[model samples]
Structure formats: structure tokens, C-alpha cells
Target: MTTGDAVRNRLGLGRLLPLGVATDGAWLTEEAAVLVLRTAVQRLPAVTLGRVRVSLADPAEAAAPTVPPPPSALPPGALRIEADFTAPADRPLPTVASELRELLWSTATHGLDLVIEETDLGVSGLSDAPAGPAGHPREKDMTAARPPGGRPAQPQGPAALAASAAPGVAHLASTLGDPVHLASDHIRVEVATAAGHRPLAVVGAVRESVRGALGNDGRPVVVLVTAVGTAEQPAEG
Candidate 1:
């Protein structure tokens, strides 16, 4: 019998989903993806977002990911956000849907820097409150979060430390033992990131840091993002 973790990993419902492409990619957990999108949608007047999710837009695509995602983690490819929401009572449904579609698109693409191909919203109910002016999502702060500087690390102790010390890394999320997995051919690092930082870039930086610590070996380095912390205040630009 398959364990729950295996099922969750395969489905990747609440796990990390691809933020960019499979070859050079990063990930944002589905939970965090939903929170970011839902927060953006909540700004829309009279709209109540619920059950937001992110997933591969084309599930049939056969692009196997290079980075091995954690158990209960997402695979690779272009992603989409699917949401259930409460429609404003006074507005025409079609107009409201169109407005929402654009908001989600902009929020996912511009705000979160996600490779979002589609924004699909379904009306679960109608809000009884009167409609008001539409609200836009808060723009993500693009200011760089500097990585911790120090002497170059070596071997496992420093490799893990270097990766953990990398920018946007909140913590290491390895399931058991060390977060740095040294296989016969490659290395894998799992991390939880801070919100507001771009996921793709963060992962790339992490891979670089880890690789550098490992003597810049020819072997490929895989970085998997397991979680993303929520931004406390929306730093609208």
C-alpha cells in the first residue's frame, strides 16, 4: 500500500509547484501560491476568494523535472491558478469575471514573478454586499535581499551552512538526516523561503551557493523549495 506521503507527493496538491521551467526552475508551495493569489484577489471590492490552488496548466506534458521535489511536492512545467470565489452581487457576472481574471494574471505574473499561463476562477456563491471599486494587488518589492557574506564553506558542515545562509532561505526542509543529499552523480538541497523574494532566483542562488561549497563540481545541483513564509506587510511599490 502506498503511504500518504507518496500519494501527496504524486498529487502535489498542497506541496511545492513549479515557479518557472523544469531545467532551471524554482518552486512555490501550493499553499503559499494560494495565499499570495488569494491575498491579491481579496483586494477586489466585494470579492471573497477561497480554495485557491496552483498546478501545471498542461498535465499531459511529459517534461520530467531535473530537480527532485520532496515527497508531497509538485512536478515541473507552466503553472495556472484555479480559484473559487464569491461574486459581487450588484455587478454583471461576466464583467466581474473578466476583472478578476486580469487581477489574478497580473498578481501571479508581475507581483509574484510566477510562470502563470492561466487564471481560472469559479463562482461558488454571490456576495450580498454592494459592489465597490476594484482593487489591485500590492506590487512585490524588487529590492534585493543580500546573501550573508563570509568565508567560503567546505564539505557538508559548510555546504549546509552556505545553503542555509543563502538569501531567501528561511530554513532547510530535508525530510530526514541532512538537507544536502549527496548522490552518486548529483546533490539535492531542500529549502523553505521567505515571502517577497522571487522563488526562481532564490533557488538558483541556493544551487550556486551549494555548488560552490561542494568545490564547484561538475555534478548538477538540485534545489527544491518546500515552503514559503507569508509576507507580513504588503510592500506596495
Candidate 2:
């Protein structure tokens, strides 16, 4: 494969963190979450971010979300955000680090609606000058976002229609096969979220919409958020 292809491959999502509690929650892609996080961090003064990653703080004690993550997502639980940053040498280092830590914590919890447990910080570089506007959100190509095993979205009758029509949902997806999967005990759908909405909120709306459309069949409705659209990348029809 080409070098760009290889790099892009690595950019594909790592672990899908749970958005809510074990009873009712949604899975969010690391890349999608990072896009929101990076944007928020860039607003900080005298700080330039380095590598950033999010994962379960303690997988051993993590509880799986109400809806188990698909094969593409990580096991559910409280997660953490760890990153390397450059602080201004002129300012008090502790203060700068504290600001960075608060920003990470607030963005992950309040902004992204993630169930984050920790925010680990490390010093990577020091700068005397103020931070510049070189910060750009991750260029994640989420046009093809879908459930891990799902391919492109396919016509799944009324069920697919209901899922797409839900608020905050961009569209239905599957990395490999049809977007909607039907089983004896449950129904699963992977979706890309619409811009300007929380991924977890979108997931909840979708679950409700699909559930209503399908009626009470004793088969639970499952929704997975595979991709989230940014302001620059508005969701498609």
C-alpha cells in the first residue's frame, strides 16, 4: 500500500469510548472525539498540543455500556484522555498545566459528553511566545463511517428509513455489509452523526426512532455511532 494509505489506515478509529452509563450509552470514535478535543485545546493561550489519545482508565473495572459496543468499539467504561503539550516558559508552569488539564477535562466531559475519568498531562515542549492559530482539527474522512463489520448502507426497508430520519443522525452505515442488521433477539444499526450535535445524543435519538418504527418485538434496538460530522464536513443525506 502507499504511504498515505498506510498513514490513513492508522488514523482509522482505535477504541470506541462509551458516551453514557452502562444502561444507555453510545460509542464514539477516537478520531471524531479528537477532532472536537483538538479544536477546544487550540483555543487555549500559550499552549501547543502534541500527541493526544483517549482510552479506558481502568478496563478491569469498566462496565460495558447498556448497549454493548460492536466489534469495532472498545468494551464500555470510564475513559481517560492523555496528551503531550508545550507550555510557555515565561508563565507559571503549574498554572499552564492546570489550565490545559481543565480544558481537557471540561471538553471531554461537558462538551463531548464522554464519561471521562482522568486527564493525564505531560510536558513535551516549552515556548516563550504565545500559541498561534496553526491548530487545525484532525482531517478525519468520515464520509464512509459505519459499523466495523458493516460495509456501505443498503436499503433495509422501513427500519433504515426510520434510522436516517432521526434527529442528529447523518445517515446509516456499515463497513462491510448492509447498514441494518436483523437478528432473532435484537436489531443493530451503525450511523454517522450530524454536525452541531453531540454524538451520544444522536445515538439516543436514533435508538428511540428505530425502536418506535419497529415496535415492541422483544428484540432490543442497538445503535452505534461510527462517525461524527464536523462543521466543515456537514452530514450527507
Candidate 3:
């Protein structure tokens, strides 16, 4: 490893070029933020992280001059954090998602000192378990601006459909222990298994849950079984 590699590993902040002038000094890297986010999500119950993606607003967007000027020409650390996770079916999905969102939002805002523009939670699967308490799940209301075409714009974001899928499936099978990756309308799930568990069965279950949460919108959902461990030693998410 060279000096550049070491610096890049420690502070994954990318090159800063403003009007062809390169700026010096290290900023927070996406990897650093992801580490913080993953650790935080792991601490939550039934919330296993599959994947984490972070997007920072363009610095040029803030550089534009306006009346009275924006809040300091210094680039603001605006962040949009998205994650794919699996939770036990027994636990309320909305509640789990809400807690995770608050946890990440606080971690980004207070711990990392970054501005959280949006934190989208994508539930990739549920661990298999017994039936949950009987009750109709609360409906989520999403309003969108209608375009000139007159068709109401559809709701976007992973959190939009979590509630509907919570009660349908029992807890997800534990074998699908790996993390998930989701962005826009795409979902990629990584499943881990043991010698006794059937990988295909687990993947099918996860796919069903994903379909339930996302609906049959024709979006692509990819599930990959990445690891198989012995019964004594299980794979990690």
C-alpha cells in the first residue's frame, strides 16, 4: 500500500475541484459515514443491514451566488442516506424502520455533523417466525404532484410501502442473514445460509417479502446467496 492508498482508505473523501482549482484538506468520506451507519443499524433489534448508500449534494449547487448569499460559501455536508435491511416479521416493520431512521438521522446530524436531507429505508426481507398479532395494518397516505399529463405521480422511496408487508409474512428465515442493497426501484439482496437450511427456499421467501413491500411494479429485485456456514458457525450479515 502507498501513501495515497492509506489516505484514501482513512478519509475516502474524493478530489475537490472548484472551477478547475483543486482544494486541499480532507472531508468526510462515504465509507466513513457508512461505517457509522452500519454499526448504528446493527444495534437495532431485528434490523440487519444489507447495504448502505450515501449521496452528498453537489458542492457546485451551493457555490452559486444568490441575493444575500447562502449560508457560508463553505460546502454544506448535506447527505441522503439509503439502506436495505431485514427485520423479524413479528416486529412492526414501520416501527423498526422509523427507529432505524431516527437512529441514522441522529447519527448523521449529531454524531457526524452532517445534514440529513433524506434517509430512505428499504426492507429487503423478513425472518421467518410465527404469526404476528391479528390486526389490520395502518394505511400510509402518500400525496404527489400531478404532472401536465394528468396522471398522479407515483410515490417513490423505499419507506413508501413497508407497512403493507409487515403482517403478511411471518418472521423471515434466519438463513438470509446477509445485507441488502437498494436504490431507486432496484433491490439486491445478499443471503447467507447454514448447511441445514435450503438456500433457494430462503431466497424465495425473501423475494416474496420484497415483492409484498414493493408491489408488482415490475422493478428488478436480485437476491444472491453469498455464504454458507456450518451449523456451529453462522454467516454474518
28-104: candidate 3 lDDT, tens digit per residue: 33443465455545456545677777665555544332111111122434556788988778878888788888988
lDDT of 1 by residue, 1-237 (tens): 346455544544365576667787456556555656666665677877767777778878726777555444457767877888888788899988898899888777755556788788899999787766655432331121222111122335867888988998777764322577777777777676776666666788898898888798777877766555546432333
Off by over 4 Å in 1: 1-15, 72-74, 131-156, 174-178, 229-237
Q: Is candidate 1 or candidate 2 better by lDDT?
A: 2
Q: Model 2 over residues 83-185: C-alpha lDDT tens digits?
A: 9998878778899899889878877776567888899999998997754443432233232232232233655688888888889877787642367778776
In order of appearance, the predictions have TM-scores of 0.74, 0.77, 0.40
Q: Which scores higher on lDDT, 2 or 3?
A: 2
Worst 10 residues of 1 by lDDT: 141-150
lDDT score for residue 73 of model 2: 58
Candidate 3 structure lDDT: 0.44
Best by lDDT: 2
Q: Using lDDT as the measure, what is the rank order of every candidate, best first?
A: 2, 1, 3
Return the TM-score for candidate 2, rounded to 2 decimals: 0.77
Checking candidate 1 for backbone clashes, the offending pairs are 9-72
Candidate 2 error regions (>4 Å): 1-11, 132-156, 229-237
Model 3 CA deviation exceeding 4 Å by range? 1-26, 57-60, 64-77, 129-237
User: Alpha carbon lDDT of residue 72, candidate 3?
Assistant: 17
